[model samples]
Target: MSYLRISDTVVETYRIVHYEQTNFLNRLHGGDMLFFLVETGMLSATKVAKGTSLLASLDDVVFKKPVKLGDIIRVRAETVYIGNTSLEVEINAFNQNEEVVSAYATYVKVDDLLRPVPVGVKIVEENEEEKRKIEEIKKRRESKLSKIADRQKMRFRTEDITEGIRYKISNVIHVSPELTYDGKIMSAGKLLKLMDDIGGVVCFNYIGYNNSTDYTSGAVVTVAVKGLTFYSPIRLNDIITIRAGLIYVGNTSADVIINVIREDMKGLKEHVATAYFTYVRIDKEGKPIKMPKYIPVTDREKNLYEEALLRRGLRK
Candidate 1:
């Protein structure tokens, strides 16, 4: 097998946070940051894989600091590990010198037919530092795999929403050409932005803001995202069904779970991706405000509530 140096797979890009990329509070949107990270990660992976790379899973994404408008954000991504058919990328975004966002994403190398293919190249460590970093990456991957196995055993159906403050909404959108990178499969970054948009809508609806006239009530801003996994790829012209539901609420924060389902022309539907987004309610001054508490009335609600609590604890 051929070997490629880790430096050969490094990709870096910079962009100024535009006005359109900011939220209502004039801060960089979390989803936009995710888009940039995924884009950079894919570029780095493709350099080593020698073909298309599809995002398979992302985890441990934490927003450390809020990026303001006009701030120049620099993102750096590099392939840290090479598996048989998959690779892991570590991406970091910084404002000047301080790190603001960090994420690890796994991508599967795919051929023209979109089938997983073995990566023909392996990463060559240049020094002890690179070797140590790869070891850490392996450890993290193993831990994540164990957690996924445990979560699968739980098998809690997220579609079951019964009473209480479980505000839910569904939106449909046609996957346009602009959303795809290879003119066929949709870009994961665009799908993430759509998910975050629907998630914010669900949070606002739960807090009693249903229309434009309710703007004076309050605003919701995303703080963090946890365990975003893409089980299948979305294709071009596919009808995407995005479902968002309020799962748990705290003093000033709430957890919204968004599920994306794709339907082809022939009417076959598949669950594409699912993630838990944490948002905080803020007033006109952008200060945290008290949100209405959520009470679990059904078994499903309780289960989801407990799971959210677990995720929250893990975040801490």
Candidate 2:
């Protein structure tokens, strides 16, 4: 079996410039972009791994650029290294101008049951079809993110206000599922799961880690729901955008800002929910690890921690 073959997977594309994707600055939110990138990476890896990995863990990521509406966004995934039981994959996101918006990610290999398989077991029987798929993914990588490039595109309802006070990233990041909420949104454990997903996305998509790695996610050292706000009740069909961005990096923990936005404006542009979370980075044994600098927010993100703590403290 050939040890390596370049591949390409065009996961998703959109001209969507909905307010739900922007933050208080009215620009595309970082947290939501992270979520989308990670989810897409997982899908691509599953296709290559034949559904053997359960997305065991993620490391870290840095956002190099921003993506806006009318900029055809494209995501590509490819295998860089593969082990008997895990694989290292790199993911890249591009804007219409073909500039890299984000990079890097890693994925672990799982077995037929979606559980982590043994650390060193062959996962796939290579074939020509797999090679072709890899090539297709590569073709996209060499091309521009927006094929329509310089062509003029339709401006949206909020196009004129790119500099306006933006909608906080609630809509892009923290999407309450269309299903009921028996406190799933507020559950500390559930919130931790969201944190994992967030980190996984960063490491796998932005930092170029692959799904076939051997590392596993650790435990939570700190999970503070800094603050949460609701404009109106969120219901079905409203795209739940769960967005997150880095706040502070410690030797072993990092703070993240998360938000969930729905069409709850009641037909207006009102933010629905927001949160500030601090998670401890840990190893497979669940021990805290150090993290360096990461992506930062562009809007007013000052002393929001103390504010979130106050809100989380006052029980309803």
Candidate 3:
């Protein structure tokens, strides 16, 4: 327990030997499989937080490849940074062939009422590699982030105020038609891989973090995938974009809206999937973490937002 830090856990290094982890295409389901990746990260956070960490916020997550039912899956998690009360964890799930299949988020610590709480976290001594990792994180947070909260709220905010930034998740799928059993071009699992990869990039890769972090590392807080959806067949060379914006911030978590759009196709640009996932901010032990007070919404964000709160309810 004392060996854990804000960003260092890789619990999911197993194979998807059963059909349960896959989809109709004999591959992992985008939403279900991603959740499994998240579970590994969450457990790590909970362990490092001394069981005090709770999921507080979740940002962009995407799937990159289709994990066949028998393929090996590897999940890794690490703490990005730790504040007085909150921390961030980045989760990455890969396939047996060393290909990343999905991305996920766990949270910081929280209280019994689901409120952010600052709990004691055991920090291990930092090494040269640790120093480099932390510096890279600082640079990314400083450069890319538009000033999200060190602590977040629960509940998707109806207002748009992401500090002039919109979260984006995208995927580039170049699958062969031969892989399809029937005339179907692609399977839902493959689509999920694309989304997870894109979302992972938006969440971590773009900044710099990749591969996997150590077991002791941790993030400010962790987030989870509430749900997922897929649109028409995604063929080879399709450039897809997934954008997430602030919806609402509850006392314990932040609600975000995700939008998926395919650029390769012409004609209709339907909304592929939108979901609501809740995460608790906690320490390494799974205790809850406190969230920020408030973040002001912007008029532009609101205007660009889809205001699909009503449609979200129908996603069950």
The alpha-carbon deviation from the true structure for residue 209 of candidate 3, after best TM-score superposition, in angstroms, is 37
Candidate 3 local lDDT, 1-316, one digit each (tens): 2445544553544546487654334655555565555456666666666655544434456444446677767777777555545555667777755655444343556554445666455445268777676676556444423334321221222232234644444333334564332333333344434444344334332223333434122212224454443223344444445555544444554445455554454533433444544333333443454544434356644543334333335223
Clashing pairs in 1: none
Q: For each candidate, C-alpha RMSD in Å?
A: 3.1, 19.4, 18.6
TM-scores of the models, in the given order?
0.90, 0.40, 0.46
lDDT of 2 by residue, 109-154 (tens): 6553434554442223267776564455345433422432422231
Q: Poorest 10 consecutive residues of model 1 by lDDT?
A: 153-162
Ranking by TM-score: 1, 3, 2
Error of 2 at 85 (Å): 1.7
Best by lDDT: 1
Off by over 4 Å in 3: 1-10, 13-17, 60-62, 102-106, 122-125, 139-316
Candidate 1 local Cα displacement, residue 291, angstroms: 2.2
Q: Model 3, residue 259: what's the lDDT? A: 51
Predicted structure 1, TM vs. truth: 0.90
lDDT of 3: 0.47
